[model samples]
Target chain A: MLYIDSISKGIVIDHIRAGAGFSIFKYLDLDKADFTVALIINAPSKKLGKKDLIKIENKIDLDLAMLGFIDPNITVNIIEGEKIVEKINLSLPRRVEGIIECKNPRCVTSMERNIVHKFVLMDEKDGVYKCEYCDQIYSWEG
Target chain B: MLQGKHLIDPEDFSIEELGSILELAEDMLNNQAKFKDVCNGQILGTLFYEPSTRTRFSFEAAMIRLGGRVIGFAEPGSSSVMKGESIPDTIRTVASYVDIIAMRHPKEGAPKYASYYSPIPIINAGDGGHQHPTQMLTDLFTIKEVKGKLSNLTIGLCGDLKFGRTVHSLIKAMSRYENVKFLLISPNELQIPEYIRTEILANKDIPFTEVERLEDVIDSLDILYMTRVQKERFFNEADYIRLKDSYILDKEKLKLAKDDLSILHPFPRVNEISYEIDEDPRACYFDQLKYGMYVRMALIAKLLGVA
Candidate 1:
């Protein structure tokens, strides 16, 4: 295991579902962020069996609700001055706008340019979202 | 309250709203002349991205019968969609010209998407095997007219359950009623999707059963909803060929049904129901066309706030 220094101040997104760390990275646009970021994939966990962890070394504002929609198992810990300040437990977002694209070809957003794909979280425990326009269900499961 | 409402799915209307539409339909059935000119000045814009004679003609006839005018393309080739115009732009442009829109696209949720940008009420004519709310409304109207009530009925949905949008919508719509048991009839290869079975039916505690042969439960069904197994829905032609003739409702099959069993099909059917059975008194499929027109008229008038 490679060791990395603990962040002095920033957000640590932990307990992501196994194999979902890359999606969270892309979903949060962490690739383009101007901050020190450490992505630990396939970390062993007693609860999840295997998981991904993301440590961001900056006080960044983010939609943790949307993150919960991506992976409900995810937990976020905000650290300030190398001490835990806030911890966000993940739960399904009631509604999400523009974070994900509607893949259904018949979805209006697919043909209409520049229209934000708005989704309403229908089943929170299942993390199922339904398109506001066409009622197409999108779950977090592939 | 249904006036100026966008109906994207069968559930978009509350049970009360559905009742209101059904009530209006009943009134129209009793006194057709009273609603003949209900929408005299209103205009309906029909935006069909795919080819559809039955749906397009139904909407146009309904609007015309209500003294409302319709202006739209029968297909995308004539519209700005051929020029690569986005659906939002087309809907935005059409909203400026019409009081309401009846849109049909090959995509599953096109109308729902358009509803976001449209200022006027948007009726989903059919969206890419996703929804056909008006058709479901018409079906309910037909069922009530024939059977005298929407509840306490066993409806058997046969053929292509996986790709049949009408079956899916009707199932969802009827699930709202009391004692609506479903006898899902189809080949194992063409069985209803699991989500519909588990989420829509089982989750709601609606009693249902799956069967491969229609003849097995024909005597028990109050309504026999037949659908064509479309060639387009299958990936492998061999699979389509094998399943295409699985359930042909011939005169012999009709012998198994009840005397008052109402048979319906959302048409352009290919070989699902034999022509010999069309003369049977129980075949209410043809009547569905007329009821479809009247129900659509009620829907349009209600959506436009005329009724």
Candidate 2:
């Protein structure tokens, strides 16, 4: 029974995995924003037992697909004039760059400092991203 | 269809393309004189950023045997690379003089990166623990030539499976065939990575088992692929010493294996296989070494569209 005011013009990133809201907040650099942003953690939901939500009172260019890649269970709500305008569903991103790193130490990106780390989705069901240069499988968690 | 193709990974080609290369390799092996001057007056540029005697010699021999001349540097110090030239610049310049470029670089994916810029076909000789498609081609050639077929065999891959690039590529290539079972023998610290186990084996529904000892599974193998526990791959000297001698294939261990079990190693083997085992007829490493040259011959000519 937690309540927060809905935004008239903004985006609400919903259905974030419980305890992952702060990471998404920091990942998006929300702290540097001039507009009001609220990160709600451990919110009860029907789809997920507990989830995290981020309400931003500004229309910013967010890559919802990338957010989906970070956690596929995520949903994004675009609001205008206190009404839901659009809902974006996220899925595994086919290509990602600079957001994550290849864990393989022998990867070419590990050796060449100037190279950009890029990965392409190899398996959607498994959420596998392989390094573009060295073909090393990249995982977010060790 | 292989002409002007850059071999970055074994999976880069379809099974039919690989079969074509294998077919050409057999043709060249049986009738060397018939295709002796296939690449006559053509040139092969070998750009070795890392020091490699066996791989460099094999490519050079393959080109020379096909009546092609060799040009290029063995090490970076001798080339313009010493001037801090980028890989793209060097490959672009080298492509102008040679029909195809075979490069071994210290940085992984360097050849793949170079292939993006070079006009000629780029053969990756060895890229830092990354895909060495040519070596895998040589390995497949060895297995197919000796075993009389490539399908329906139990392959035991032993030692340093984690860091052995040859083993990684070979596993990916062999998993394409039917009825291929993998007995992945390695210490707990050197087990095959989860990506490989899950992606290559589990995804393909290829049967495989992980074990610590070679002796426990040697008798059941149709082919035993041995790899060195390289000191360079170890994080510390203590772990290197502790696991280095764990699986030496002496005569005692060989007795436990099948008589027809073909022993293959991507050489300069460092004490993994005992020198005494060199006398055994099943010891195919030396002949396998010869097959490396033939396979490279087939690969080079096919890439150049000369064969």
Candidate 3:
């Protein structure tokens, strides 16, 4: 059995879908972090058969919008003095920027320089996000 | 109050603001010389990245008639964009030399992107199949002129509803008023977009019905907004040939329509509208084109804070 020690103070991103940890890590820019960071893939969960988890030893502002967009089922646990201080349940962000890139070739984002790819939550029930620029409907599942 | 603002969508302005512009346009139409020098020292930059005839010319005529000088390229090939300049760079450079701009780009949201970097007002002339706010203004102005009001009328939108950005904008803009019902006439392959059907009409509780035949709804409409139903939109030629004539507004179709039914079409219309119907008293399309120019004149003057 492989065991990993938990951090005394930092953020533990938990319940990421089994194969989605790497993307979350890259999105959070934790791959380039100098501090202690552990990306544990396929950790056994009672809720999910298997899930991904990220333990960080440094305090960083986790982008809620990104975490919400990627998977709202994920939870963010803030630890302090070896105890969970605050727990955050993710929900769809009303607006997202610089997270999902628009795949529409005819969108202005394709030709413009230094433009932020923005999407607004259009249908919360269906988890639908629409590109703010081109009005392209993006399904959350894909 | 609308000084130095960008018009990226039809909903960008409040109902009152649109009314003010239309009012100014009406006033300008009645007394052209009184508003001739309103934009005397101002300059308008017309940056058309794509090829366009009517929109480009109308904007130029609007600025010129208002005594405002015009500058900029008609196509990207003639400008620094051919040398690989970014939209921001182009907008930044052009905005410095002009008081306001009317721009047309093939990419959706290109003008919206330019508005972020542009110091002056950026009027979206036409942006892909997404938006054409000025065209919406022209449409609304024409409806008000010929029909005498923007509300309490059954507006029939025919032809290529799926790809008709102008029709979509007109629907959204007209929805702001009271008692505006829509009869969307299009083939099954080219019906109104699902999002528009749900988000705009259904969500707003606006009354709208989808029909395949134009002749069936022509008699009931107070105004008929016609758009080209292109043959290329169909998947197969058989489908195109079978469904094409159903949308064509011929003399037979006009015979069933109301005598006071004001017809409006954004110009360069194809065979969807029969040329024979052009001389009809109800045909206000040519007058609509002139109203487009007058609406643009009011738009430029309002955006420049000269109105």
Candidate 4:
């Protein structure tokens, strides 16, 4: 069990895979921010044997759409006055831009400078997205 | 409607559309020197999120041969992608400058997403192992050019059927024709994926049979489409060593095939096809590459509305 001192208001990202919490933290640039953020790794969870949580002190614009690519099972909860205000279940975006890299070596994006890699959601249930140019499928891992 | 359409799958094109493209391809093949300036003022934007030298070269050569300008990168490292730019923004920005777009990525449906955000037409060069429609067109054109007919033929697909996107796309495309049977040859581990067999073959009631040895059915094949079985695809070196030579096509195997049986390969071949067999009149892979270029020229011309 792990707990963080209460903050005025912010959000809590739960159910992150153990050891992956730091990746999410770095990906969202959590440490560089001025907000009081708590990252607890290897916490107890019934669903997952081990999990991680990130509690932020300040409420910022969080791109919930990206959580699906990071970890689909993650749950985001907004905290207001130390109370849960809103729970936003991160659903996979129909199209993911610049989140996941295209693994095809011959893609123009691989050679070009300053291009955004894009993928369209083909099967939401399967967490499958197709590359716009190549039609390759990428699945999100939980 | 095809002007801005997304080609995510080979079956996305109807028979009429395929015929139109094929007819255009034939014209391009017949009068190669006459159609050089068809796309002089146009631009083709290639957004490859994945690396494919064969496909990239095919599209680039096709556009350049048509007098169209080509732009874009072969990889993501040199681009704003290294700076974390979004795919939609990239697509929209590129679409603003180009007349048409061809993209290749490792994600399955990336092209479909780009199509949604793109103002120009999006051609899926390849998306992972999911789809490669142009290759299908190339295969179709090759079959038509060599075998002289797409229907009423026994096409033997040998080697890595499970992950061979070319075989899958070819089967899906050829299944639409009349009276075609498939001889699917592969090791147990490399058999055709069940989803393909259930959804494309059995569901459509197309006649197909699975076998381990190509020797059993080589004599009856009108077309033998061979794909490489990479050493990495096998679980162990022993299995790779055991089964590697099983699917190889040399002069010995050629003896079992018909005199007119056309041999096709998607190239960059390893030991799956012996070099000694290249001189045989039946070897049509090189001719297939030339036909591929012609068909792609036709496809580009037709899709660009110049043909």
Candidate 5:
């Protein structure tokens, strides 16, 4: 029953888990970007009982892996002339840098400065990721 | 194929590659004099960001016996690291002088991090309580040399399995072999990490059993790998005092073990193996200690492509 105007050429990030909309908003820097983005939260979803949706009114290059890391079920629909042109389906990212820190106090990343925290996807189904430097296991909530 | 490779984990090398290194180590053990000058012109950088006298000495000795020179600091205080030089930068600087580097740090994955920026070969001597591939290599060499095989045996990993990187690497490396079962013995507080339990053992369908007492399973083991169990892991003094004596491998416990059972330990011992167990024929820690050096020699030679 909620209505928002569709963008002619932009992206639609749909099916975000209900509570995860803010994180995706911050990850996209939508608040600071020079464009119009409408964040619709708690929208009724067919797959997810309730979901969050993001509508960007201008085309932007998104870090799909970051979005996938935030929520894998998110669908990124690219639109042109108000018609969907492309769809990018994302799974777990193979490697993520500067995100997903190694929480182990004894990890090398903890002992250094200016080192990019790196994690590699070890198991897709299990959402298992491993720190590249220390081998600490990290599980994605998604 | 091992040439210029960094051994960050035991799984870095395939079974055949590990087999090749161990076979070369065995050959070096037999014909020691032939390898005297194999690395005559090379130099090894021993970068011990934290103080580990035994592992540092082992690498230095290994390189020296191969007719190479050793250089580097034993502590961060002696190196530029104290001034906040990063691991990658420090490795890049040291790689200019040495053909290969053996590094040990208190931080897990320090060596792996160094390998990323290092132009030369990087050998992880020990990284926090993370992976220690060479110690695992030393263990595999000792077991294979003693038992004449790496498979069809039950390996009993006793004490501190949770934080013992050597046990983690050994279990992973040996899991690739055929029919190598594991008997993990640790107090409830010091059991193996769940990632290892689910990812490595259970995922591969390897047979394993977790137990608190060692005596109940001493006779079931073909090889007993002992590691120290610290009192701090226990919840209280009463628990530590109650369970402290359970893991000690004394003469009374050794008598219950199999006749040809090989007892191994990564040394710098602390009451894990009583002094009384030293005279036994199967006390392989001393020889295992020596094989630690031999394995390093083989590893360095292979990395430098000199042997």
Candidate 6:
């Protein structure tokens, strides 16, 4: 039942799975940002009955591809002057570099001192990303 | 062109390239003393993200026998990786110090990522349940060395096909040869993956048959490849106990096999094959290990463009 007052600008990230909004917050480093940010957890939604929402009150740069990985169902609405300016529908990124650690213990990245873990989005509907080297798939849990 | 190639999958190399490497392997096998110092003064880096003493030592032994020095860590906890360095950054830094790298990671395609950012050649030692191209190389070399041909044979692959990375690689490698038929024997739970059947075998129209029992067709095989069925691969202790002994190769099973049939295994087996069978001339598992080293030496030399 908690909602923020209408903002003049910035973005509203919608449809995040309940409680996962905090992961997005950390992933995007929003806590360190200068923008005014509000995280609404477990909010009722017509589309997603219980979901999370993030409202940012500053025009900050974002990587939509990365957002897709965090939660593909998320909808990003960019607002300017109290009106919607742009809406980015999430699409899984083709390749993600250095953003997430591969959970696979056998991955070469686990041994090498300075290598980055990279994954390519193979199946978006299934939320599956394949390791670029080992070809193991990583799927998002519902 | 070979400088940045990542050997994540066996299919990464075309048949022509495999043949070229095989030919180089043959030369190195023949003139072992002549090329013993081919890699002298160069360093081969072994970065094992997972524990595999067998594979790590094979690569290390190959480098040492070829007069090359070896460096790098076998475990992740001992390295800077424990501190949170990424895979690409680690490979980039290692590529600066070594001429070549052989990496074993539990995640499939980890070596491929390293290859992308690495300045040197990246050889995949093994990647989870996906591919073990070097093991395939060793297997192919051993088969050709013992049987004298890569074709016109019925090769029996027995046990744990579902999770056996070596079986998957061997099948892909052998499928490239002429008149090769496979008799895949495993429990229903351990059948080969659909991708291996559809993408590599059946799609290519290679003749193969699948069966649940090994003793049923043990007599007809020219080459018997035995893999251990680990207790961990089973769902429960009861299932492991039920299937474990059935897959074991004793003298009774070998009695049915052809006298000249060559038996191969990527070793460290746990009771999959009886010791009595080791006395038989047909047991070539130990010899396969030796051939493994030679094949690796050949691979290193060829990849370095010095063969």
- Of the candidates shown, which would achieve the greatest TM-score relative to the real structure? 5
lDDT of 1 by residue, B1-307 (tens): 9877899888888999999998888788778899888898989999988878888999999899899899999889997899998888899999999999999888777787788788899999988766788889989999998999999999999999988889989999999999999999999988886557867998799999999998899999999999999886666999999899998999998998899999999988999999999999999999898888888888988888888
Sorted on lDDT, best first, the list reads: 3, 5, 2, 1, 6, 4
Computed on alpha carbons, the lDDT of every model, listed in order, comes to: 0.87, 0.88, 0.89, 0.82, 0.88, 0.83
Chain B of candidate 2 versus the native chain B: what TM-score? 0.96
RMSD of 4: 7.9
lDDT of 4 by residue, A1-142 (tens): 4456876688899888788899899988998988688999999999999999898988788777787677777889889988999887777788788877777653545644566788887667777676564544566775
Write one digit per residue (lDDT tens) for candidate 4, span B5-120.
66768888898889888888888888878899999999998888767778888889989999999998899886777786777888889989998888887655567656768877
Can you list the residue pairs that collide in candidate 3? none
On TM-score, who's better, 1 or 4? 1
| lDDT per residue (tens digit) for residues B154-268 in model 3 | 9999988876778878998998899999999888888886668877899789999999888888899999999876554445798767766667788998999988999999867
Tell me the tens digit of each residue's lDDT in model 5 across A29-131: 8999788899999999889999999999998889998888988888999999999999988778899889778898888889788888999888889899888
State in Å the error of residue A121, model 1.
4.1
Rank candidates by DockQ, best first.
5, 3, 1, 2, 6, 4
**TM-score of each model, in listed order:** 0.89, 0.89, 0.91, 0.68, 0.95, 0.71
Q: Between the candidate structures 1 and 4, which one is better when assessed by lDDT?
A: 1
Q: Can you tell me which runs of candidate 2 are displaced by over 4 Å?
A: A1-10, A17-46, A49-59, A79-85, A122-128
Measured by TM-score, how close is model 4 to the native structure? 0.68
* Higher-TM-score candidate of 1 and 3: 3
Scored by Cα lDDT, where does model 3 land?
Answer: 0.89
Off by over 4 Å in 3: A1-6, A29-52, B230-246
Give stretches of model 5 more than 4 Å off. Answer: B230-246
What is model 3's native contact fraction? Answer: 0.72
lDDT of 4: 0.82
